[model samples]
Target: MPSKIPDVVAPGTLARGEQPVIPVPGDLVIRPWVLADAGAVYKAFQDPLLQRWHARVADSESEARGWIEEWRASWADEHNAYWAIAAAGSDEVVGRIALKSVVLADGQAEVAYWTMPEARRRGVASRALTALAGWAFDEVGLHRLELTHSTANEASCRVALRNGFATEGTKRSAGPHEDGWHDMHLHARIKGDGPTALV
Candidate 1:
């Protein structure tokens, strides 16, 4: 039988005004961000936890819109895919995820994400990742998806593990924080990992 899986996603296939909603279960939906989400995005970044992990400080709505524009440009450049994690029935930006450092030739990419304080502990990140990983593998024809987080972030560590990513090892002094550099842990899920299944 012919393969039903989609072939490699063509680079530059995702352009501005062309947001694709990755199919995944649950009440969540992933959508392309809009400038109107700037306020929510700005508020999420105000969390000290988020700011510490990302080393980003966008204290103003204007700066948040700038961040959204950068995300739009990433799609146009075909280097990254960033999505606003929102409720299925609403447009509020409760979280965000990104497939960064895309290499279509190598069929690899790095995945990263953060949830607003209200969105945590609700499986938001995990479901978002499961959806993104499935799209990256089943639809985008990616071979490998990588995730890295500071060793100190227990929440992200759990999210990675729950999303079919296996711990590879630690990158020493690879993470920066307000205090100083910290150790970083690497995890990865291959194309055949199969939907974050429980063993």
Candidate 2:
């Protein structure tokens, strides 16, 4: 028989800012999603800057609500895990971090993230990514986690590089994003028994 998958089931909070959200720094908290977060997610995705990089476009309020509804449902499933990024003092969501599709055959998983336009350039994404990746590797026992970002997004590339995710290669026409085709830079890191730092 096989063992169970590791998760952050322990009762410690991931900190951010002065207030308690996740105890993570940089005024942000990366924690599991809840029904209360739906409104925040919808509002954050409405930002023009975020919509530019996201794969799906939400032109109407109902569409955004529907997306959040789906995300909420998916988060409840074991195969898909999601963490809402929120301001430490308030429940207002600033972004999200996720680990999905844990493939047992290859022992691999895909990582994804996003942040509000106002939250940019504050080391929020980098720190949150490192913390989340560390937790995933340590708790989930995933051998390797992969991430892909548009080549044009320099900020995202820096975050991946800072998190110790080495670039494997580029995928031509990998994503149907702006500018017809987007060159996605693939990055990955390995999990081990001992401790390590991505920064």
Candidate 3:
């Protein structure tokens, strides 16, 4: 039997066009990842904070290249969308952001991001997240976006809150870190929640 409600975003919406480069405030842009960004990606994963929070590390530039290729392929698969946060006129990757675990039928995805050590304290993550959220809601027509982070990650919580993703609740021992399991905070924003601060 068919369900009463239809898909919030129909299939083929993402595949209909190439992923776009979204511009944000502070002269940064959220653009698709490319092979040339491998070195920066490899280096970013080496940061102690990033490795601890994300629970993964790029062992080499080759591994980073493979990761980039996978991100590109996911665009075609419509399962995920990843972008590099960089300056307007340069390819240097100052950060990374993505819409992961996309469920087109439900019009929802989980947002994730990490900034390079050199870019911390400069609003890079929050600014890029605002831009990506705008594109996800306005351009992709997603109905909701959600994000999760270890409750200990106060910086991530700030970024999510700053971007309009309201804190929903905490899930105990939901995330694994270098230290051990961590309580995770769940945050979400719906399409009707209105524009985020920098959107």
Candidate 4:
């Protein structure tokens, strides 16, 4: 990964506009995933809670590999930014946060995140979301970031609210989960709100 921060956009600013761009929370570094990370990400995604909540169930190792490779390609594409999260002291990936389906004209993006079961309750997801949202606003030139969680997911709701993402409403039968079609709580955050003060 490059030691220097790549040019990203700030919140409220249009990507098409002429403004100096830089990564936010500059210390919160992100890098492309190497092939070695496949195992860790696979294991993390396979966790029952994450699998059910994230709706990520691959048919086989080949499918998982394809997904990981696609994630790698997204880093270079700029339209999708998926990061393997690590704290300052550790190289082991504890979680992942992504800016997905970005629309430059709309200044909007969808955010998704998950933390390893062993790393839960340690504020890993909260920290990563804070840093990622700050970057999205400060450098990605995105004004709005949206997230969705199953209504039963209290922890994710807390993370979203703490990050200043307003709970917009529920989307009934929005999607299917391990149980069945579930209502989803939609949440959103804007650029100027700063980080969610939880932690």
TM-score-sorted candidate list, best first: 3, 1, 4, 2
lDDT tens digits by residue: candidate 1, 76-168? 776788999998877677799999998876788999999999988888899889988887788768899999999999999999998889999
| Most accurate candidate by TM-score | 3
All models: lDDT? 0.85, 0.69, 0.90, 0.73
lDDT of 4 by residue, 1-199 (tens): 7536433443324324332222224233344555667777778877888887866776656676787788766655557767777544455767777888877656788999888899899777777787777766766567889999889999999999988899899999886887899899999997787654856
**In lDDT terms, which candidate is top?**
3
lDDT of 4: 0.73
Error of 3 at 173 (Å): 1.0
What value does the lDDT take at residue 80 in candidate 2? 57
Q: How do the residues 1-199 of candidate 3 rate in per-residue lDDT, one tens digit apiece?
A: 9989999999999988999999989889999999999999999988888888987779999999999999988998788999999988875789999999999999999999999999999999988888888888888899999999999999999888888899999999999888999999999999878535652
Ranking by lDDT: 3, 1, 4, 2
Q: 1 or 4, which is superior by lDDT? A: 1
Number of backbone-clashing residue pairs for each candidate, in the order shown: 0, 8, 0, 8
Model 2 lDDT per residue over 48-86, tens place: 778778867666566666766666566434455667787
